[model samples]
Target: MTLSSSDSASLPAERLGGLLQSASFHPQQTIALGISDLAEQAKEDRADKLGISCAEEVGSVYAAILGAIVHRDAGLAD
Candidate 1:
């Protein structure tokens, strides 16, 4: 499943994981690791407004989608 920017935001974490895992775009572990990195970034950036946990969840998803864009732009995936 190739992800496009328009629809990436709507994908659930599990679904995104499945797509990344099944496609083997880059490395599954690398993508998985982004969850924590993204969550931390989100918490740092949005915790004041959205609260810690909520911002983490939002940040994780946003980061994952952004990562996908990076991968695509880098020609890591078709």
Candidate 2:
């Protein structure tokens, strides 16, 4: 997803770092939180998780997002 100035300002890495410094936290929790945060940022920017921008670029954006998601899921043969 495209990041806006406001959203990018916080940067998930910084948030992850803060969470990591906490002793009681776990990696899964961090990943979940980061994903959630990324999703929120994506929502704000009107871009999909795969960084497709349908509003500005039209159909290609949706196609790109879908293709990327599928490709990632498909990956290499096991």
Candidate 3:
């Protein structure tokens, strides 16, 4: 998934890997829902911190994480 400028600015590089790894422990549907919640939180955080909407950034992050999860599951199913 593409990282928006705001996402790169807000989320540290190292933390991204950790977030993905931790999320893998959960079910896909649960992970998707959690990502939605996280995106909303990120949007709120970015708006509060930078006074700008970060919908695109958060959406990018959401898609990236979901993609990773799906890819991982597909690999495991093979």
Which run of 10 residues does model 3 get worst, by summed lDDT?
26-35
Candidate 2 lDDT by residue in tens digits, 8-60: 46776677566556525565666567678778887877655345543557677
Model 3 over residues 1-78: C-alpha lDDT tens digits?
444578646665565555556655754654465457678878988778764346667888999999889989889534
Judged by lDDT relative to the true structure, which candidate is superior, 2 or 3? 3
lDDT scores in order:
0.70, 0.64, 0.66
Q: Write the per-residue lDDT of candidate 1 for residues 1-78, one digit (tens) a residue.
A: 245777558656776666567556555555555555566766877757667678789999999999999999999987
What lDDT would candidate 2 get against the real structure?
0.64
Q: Model 3: runs farther than 4 Å from truth?
A: 1-26, 52-78
**Which model scores highest in TM-score?**
2
- Where does candidate 2 have its weakest 10-residue lDDT segment? 47-56
Q: Would you estimate the TM-scores of all the predictions?
A: 0.34, 0.35, 0.31
Error of 1 at 69 (Å): 0.2
Error of 2 at 26 (Å): 1.3
Steric clash pairs (candidate 2): 1-51
